[model samples]
Target: MPSGRTSARRFRNHVAAMVLAVAATLVSGAPAPVAATGQVAPPATAPSPAPVYPITARIVARYPHDPGAFTEGLLWHDGALFESIGLEGRSEVRHVRLEDGQVLARAVLPADQFGEGLALWENSLVSLTWKTGLAHRWDAKTLKRTGSFRYTGEGWGLASDGKALIQSDGSATLRFRDPKSFAVQRELTVTANGRPVRNLNELEVIDGAIFANVWHRNYLVRIDPANGAVTGLMDLSALATEVAATDPEAVPNGIAWDPAKRRLFVTGKLWPTLFEIALDPAP
Candidate 1:
């Protein structure tokens, strides 16, 4: 359940129409929203806990993963799945096998840093730290630490558009950074139903939208890059029934997409099995 959320706003939104209006406003040639006086209208206030539709995952494949793996970030590229696991002292980045879930190569972070997220560029992998204001660089092929850089705030999640990195810091904002120098290029205030959406974590960029795992909740949202609007929200509460939560750190956090095969995968920290899900295809 989501924490500190008042009970009044606890209901989920079932109507798909909530996203329709926003979609129309974002595309080119759409009419601008205006007040009766012909002035631009203000943003509407969103219901505290936005309504979300429950989406059941279709398990395409299941693999044995280490139960001790505190998965923080996950990605699939060129037939391999790379994972980043976290804890102050046990944080590491791994190159894994999807068929058997074997750790073929690994690079461990120093004891003081808590690993958070990972993103892949051309030949490099960039990893974020929880509170250290730093990001580490690694060779994607060898899992070797190549170098490091810095950011201004906490690093919660990371995704790359192949040229630049998009990052979140447990806030309603997403920052776009230059891959080479890590300098921020732009940012957006992510919103759901016109209200800020915080706790954005574990992002996957596929088919022009950013899919994010909302921390501490059973929601996964698709965000529009142009206006920072959450175009779709899916409830994954039923998935929790499959695993009994025993570890305090266990939570739904990792998300990856296989572009070639058009497969979607998800798993949580300390999860024994990884899931391959078939999402509702867009009309």
Candidate 2:
């Protein structure tokens, strides 16, 4: 699936969860987990133990997505969906049609740099690189790379709060940066049940809360921007299973919010479908 620095931690979290699920089934005489079938099955009854309240992603609509796109970032603004695709030699920023997933326009990055998170700051489309420590600025309307700047450390996910840029680097810490200079202004540590949450990736700022996709996981955590505490955890394990049947690397990693329509969209790396969903309390 995903490699490099975050792979080990991702593997650990995945394996630990699977082990717990299997153990619970063996002890309780419940059905065994379907991990062998390449599906990360959800709990048959109540959700797992976690500090934050459980939320379920109720699919409202589905749309086509580019199965070859290794989606790293996604956002909806005005009336369009902009996505950042990853992988060396294949990275691009695309303006996609919401109805059919047709790429209306795209800007390619250098073959050496793996693209990551994307955000819109004012009239500019800002995108980040994974290991190169470079951030590119693009004209929101033209999709042209206007200029570039440098940043410290790895870039995983990015979002804008209408004032500043919020960035994550696979760590529990989220940095608030000056949108103009891209300088770190403040940092927030995301926590759940007093424990730090790592591998934060693909972000969307809706209303005032920060919605983040935990890398390789089928869920998104909603954090309070004022305090960094996870207020809700929305599970999409069913969708994850559906997407990963053929490719195990198709991990859910994209989130976009359409404020005007009040819709939330989610998809995954190499997925062929994008789902518009609504969150509801889990039973």
Candidate 3:
């Protein structure tokens, strides 16, 4: 019923509208086959990132620690603490008294070797050397050098989960090895907020979870051993600041957990004090 000119104008308008819609879609790069109602649905929302719960350290007690020792690894066994002190020429392993921080026994490493993480496997105590790819075994009771084994990379932190020996090579990946052969059994990549977490040092296995120190950082990350996801982060900024006040190089580096007492202790390289702490949910 419309006139020819009017019909032509309407057709042209329809073409123009279609072209505009296509242009808009192309410019936005949004997916569309226009909806049934001719409206584009919103783009799917991205999944939320995994949560990292913050943990606050509550000081339970404080014990004197050696300010001269560059502590790299620490662990508690029986009633005493075993520590590995680093620095190429000054590296040593010491059996320390918890009550007085007394060095009851000590074994100095080779001048060429820089000691790193320490862990106990059954009756033997195992220690790692930085850049040497060597791991040393000692009698847990006597601290006598029993033997040595070879590994592949730089050893930053080490811990034993009873069965396999877990080791970190300053990378995000943790390797689990056969206790006797030192052969790598499997590996787990540590992650925080969907990104790899590197510089993992001074490891301690607490209640089946791996607690690691990020090198030069003032916090400890609690990692899920099965999946390597960071479930909790314990901030030790105050403790680090306290130690750094006297010695700026005294960054946090040690973690020792007494399973029987359920007590957790932490210290730093060249720190004068070691703290017994309990983690509480951050406010």
Per-residue C-alpha lDDT of model 2 across residues 68-148, encoded as one tens digit per residue: 999999999769899999988999999999999999999999999999999999889999998899999999898999888
User: Cα deviation in Å at residue 137, candidate 1?
Assistant: 0.9
For 1-283, candidate 3 gives per-residue lDDT tens digits of 9998897567545433433442344345355233222323223111112455555457889999998989889999979999999887999999999888999999999999989999999998999998899999999999999999999878889999998999998778899999898999999988765667766889999888899986655678788999988776676777887776455456789999998988899999888999999755333
lDDT of 1 by residue, 58-80 (tens): 56777777778988899997689
RMSD after CA superposition, every candidate: 11.2, 10.1, 19.9
Clash count for candidate 2 is 0
Candidate 2 TM-score to native = 0.82
Off by over 4 Å in 3: 1-50, 245-248, 280-283
lDDT of 3: 0.80
Please give each candidate's TM-score: 0.81, 0.82, 0.80
Model 1: lDDT to the true structure = 0.76
**What is each predicted model's overall lDDT from 0 to 1?**
0.76, 0.81, 0.80
